[model samples]
Target: MSSEIADAKPTDLPKVSSGSAVVIHPRWVRITHWINVIAMFVMITSGWRIYNASPLFAFTFPPAITIGDALDGLPGALLWHFAAMWLLAVNGATYVALGILTGRFRRKLLPIRPMDVIRDLSAALTGKLSHDDLSVYNAVQRLLYAGVIAAGVVAVASGVSIWKPVQFQEVAAVFGGYDAARFVHFFAMATIVGFLLIHITLAILVPKSLRAMILGR
Candidate 1:
């Protein structure tokens, strides 16, 4: 038996461990992710303040979740909003550019067919979605991340439209007009917020993932 084992090919050997550590997120991915998080939070809070200045309807976002009720009021909110907008745009642009140049999207986010989505959704709903590993994003994660990225792009575009309607009149018209553009912007924010809540919940459920992002291993 020992002699036969010695003649066996490497592929015939029983699989061993992949070692104790794996570097999941690179420095750029981790940095961009956190930067986006901070920018997103700042934008949302300040956005609520700006929204209170000209509420969409009888309804208004709760002050508890907004910065409007804090020091500075609407003017301060606008200041924060504008400042974070620049950060979001620049950071997001860098993230996307690097993702492309590094082929990160192609390597990790693609090959996910419609069937993959259904399979992942099924696994997730049935509580079979594995949280034991963080080497690669699951299908649900890939889809959701892609969706959030799209929403982010929409947010930027709609923001630019509302900020300079005359300059981005074409964009406003594409969204059906200024009123429609604002609606679009609001919906984009809602989508982003929804994604964020889900992301946080999952991260809480899977602490390893959070640690991997922070430590890149």
Candidate 2:
């Protein structure tokens, strides 16, 4: 596992003299980040509750991770689920708006071609992936960020459809139907959880990288 970890060697891009560490993430980035984190936790916990109530799969999620079970049943979980939905939506909108206005998404995540993705994946597999700058993102990071945003959108859309099949008939139909919407909602949740796990694993493997998000050094 240690051998598979990548170092932050300098890339071939043009370079100028560099000094000590400086802040890369702005206040908005940090604020929305923590809010999203809290919101995701709440949503996931409560979503598990709702899922358990009428599971689409054979097995059920553990009661320990679900809010509804903690509070007795689906009602408690619904309270938390609805509450976090607003936070996630508002914070997500704020992040998107800021990313557009500040050009952060453009500079960091845009123009990631297939070749670039392949190269980054190869490097990561061979333990050659770089992270020279604490502020900037690697190709994999860019792709993952982009993918997670889409997953969030899917989660929200499917969630809304499931919440109101009549009102969001089009959305439910687009995803397939009532049952399909539930499947998509579960799938999106899985994707989000998978990304979070990968993000945490990578942070553990790369200590310097984690500090940037935490302390903003």
Candidate 3:
């Protein structure tokens, strides 16, 4: 079993056959998903630039990965960051609202029990998880997607606190203080980025998932 598992490759995973393709992703979902991709790119890159201005830690993001200029009071990065923030906020709200209104959330991501997650995770680790059903999300997928949405809310809240410490003193106070809010914002961003990496990796490994997103199959 160990040797068989070691010999397994990503390509060996179960895939959704092209002949069995169906509408797994709706138009609204596809649109929002792509918008999110672009918005997140701008936010993350511009965010890195903003962080370089007065970094919270010892190291800084590399210029190659970062966007905008951080010089002269950080106006460049600030503008980009704010713009992306609004885009992300509006789009994310719409996605969530529509998801709930249309019952997509309940249909696709509901009933994510703890035992299901443990069972699916164990199967995944043992290379027994299947990706043949593109229309349904596994327990792990549901948990991660739901967690990321919650993380986005946290990121936005913490960001608002950091952005307007005086105006949003109440919000900042909820996070302990202005300085503490920055930590929350940083960690939330990190969580989102980590989720994106895993999400993209899985999409690549399961090409049908990417095709479904792009072509709405």
Candidate 4:
């Protein structure tokens, strides 16, 4: 038996573990992700306060979810909003740049076919979709990530247009006018918030994915 084992080819030998760890999320990706999370929370709350200053909608976000001071009011909210805006903009830009440079976007987010989306949506709604593989995204997941990235860009552009209408008049004109730009910003924020709700729900449902993000394994 010993001689027979010695004569066996490498392929004929029993499989043994290599003992290398698998990484689902890289260090930079995890870092940027958590940073963006912090920035988003601040931006959303402060933005709600800013919107209350001159609401376009009939309803307003409750003060419970906003960041504002009774002493400083709008100016205080503006301060927080601007600070979070810079954090998000810089961090988001870094994420995009790294994604493209490393081909992460192409590998993970591209080739989102309509039929695949339809099939996945049906499976997801019926609670039959498999998320066993944390590394591979379903078609619906791909579409949502791509859409939210685009929405973030729109939010930033529309925000700049509203923040400095005189300087970014061309940008404002692209959205129609100052009033139109506000509408655009509001809708962009709504889209982001909606995406966040879905994202959080999925994270809770698939705790392993959250673990992968936190531990990168």
Candidate 5:
């Protein structure tokens, strides 16, 4: 048994090089991703600017420190925020539609089986998992992606709550109240910020993965 184990050929093990180099992310995915990036950036910046209005959850700072004095006065920022919001919304909707229409959603994003999720989770828990270990997404990756998407939706909803508090009184009430909605929005933004840091760290840890996103290899 010892000899057999020692003499086993490396070919018996899964090889990353054997993986296909086909483009995983198509043009639409790339376009939407970059658009979302820009939109998120604008939204965060403008959102911070808007935050300065009443400093919802914290002390109010001057316009010089923040991006804008008020959401309304910062017309450029407001324009950017709203425009980006529309772009992000439309691009996201298009991506979802295309994914469903093309069957890629079922084929790629969805997990293969219950066992796959278990296996991936076990590997991740053991700290033995890598991006190569996943053809699409590991359990943790899928969870995070799902989480970010959900959070995005919530952020959009809460944004509406804040945008038209009078009109969206019911929606605002769902988060407890306007102040509560503001707190939730801020917390959700913080969550995204945390995810971005982790995402960037992982991207750095795996340059090939980052390259894959860029060149769609």
Candidate 6:
């Protein structure tokens, strides 16, 4: 029996484990998500600088200094913003394609159940949620993720309205005119920033969440 085992080809040997498991991200998802993240940061920074040129929201207390104003002038900010927009568009398109190809867009993200949304919201409110308990996003998460995607589309649309008001006059009109579109763009950005804060807080609360994203567990 020992001689036969020794003589066996490598392919005939039973696979053995070292007791450690490997968790890796799906290559396409990781690449796209990270690219989106970088693009978002760039957009936010440049957008803020552009906003600084004509501070939209004024408070009694002066607004805090931001990277946008500190880094460069309006032209520089516009360049960064437009470049980041293209990157975000490409990244988003790739993510959508991958989701469709893998059916993950429908299976994991879409078709959200009402009960799951309530349960997840309740869990979040009560601070009972953990990354382990929520390996995949729950219904509320799916909704929020969907909202973010929609917001991205809206942002791009509104941005174009402002970018070329003459050429995109029709698009600008859809949002009740250019000013409305500008407001929508700013509001959408604020929403995304708010989501980012909550997301990071939750990641801190459930430490494994970041690891899962990074390692694709």
Winner by TM-score: 4
lDDT of 4 at 134: 73
What are the root-mean-square deviations of the candidates from the true structure over C-alphas?
7.5, 7.0, 8.7, 8.4, 8.5, 9.1
For candidate 6, write residues 143-166 as lDDT tens digits: 888778778888888888988888
Residues 41-149 of candidate 3: C-alpha lDDT, one tens digit per residue: 9988888888888999999888778777645436887899998888999999999998887667766788799999999999988989999988789999999999999
Candidate rank order under TM-score: 4, 3, 1, 2, 6, 5
Q: Evaluate residue 79 in candidate 4 and report its C-alpha lDDT on the 0 to 100 scale.
A: 91
Name the runs in model 3 displaced over 4 angstroms: 1-21, 70-73
- Candidate 2's residue-wise lDDT over 1-217, tens digit each? 3421232123312233355557666667788988999999999988988888888889888888777654457888899999889999999999989887766776668767888888999999999988777667778888999999899999999998999999889989989988888999999999999999998899899897667677665
Candidate 2 collision pairs: 8-131
In model 1, the Cα lDDT at residue 64 comes to 72
Write model 4 residue lDDT over 1-217, tens digit each, in one string.
Answer: 5864565455433333355655667777899999999999998899999898889979988878899777636888999999889999999999999877766676678779999999999999999999987767899999999999999999999999999899999999999989999999999999999999999999998999899889776
Taken over the whole model, the C-alpha lDDT of each candidate is: 0.83, 0.83, 0.87, 0.87, 0.70, 0.74
- Pairs of residues clashing in candidate 1: none
Task: Estimate the TM-score of every prediction.
Answer: 0.86, 0.85, 0.87, 0.89, 0.72, 0.79
**1-217: candidate 1 lDDT, tens digit per residue:** 5864575455434333366465677778999999999999999988987887788878887777876445548877888899999999999999999887766775567656788889989999999888776766788888988889899999999989899889889988888888888889989999999999999998898888899789877
Q: How badly does each model clash, as a count of residue pairs?
A: 0, 1, 0, 0, 0, 0
List the lowest-lDDT window of 10 residues for candidate 5: 8-17
Better of 2 and 5 by lDDT: 2
Better of 1 and 5 by lDDT: 1
**Per-residue lDDT value at 33 in model 5:** 77
Predicted structure 2, TM vs. truth: 0.85
**Model 2 Cα shift for residue 169 (angstroms):** 2.2
Is candidate 2 or 4 superior in lDDT?
Answer: 4
TM-score of 1: 0.86
**Which candidate, 4 or 6, would have the higher lDDT against the true structure?**
4
The C-alpha local distance difference test score for the whole of candidate 5 amounts to 0.70
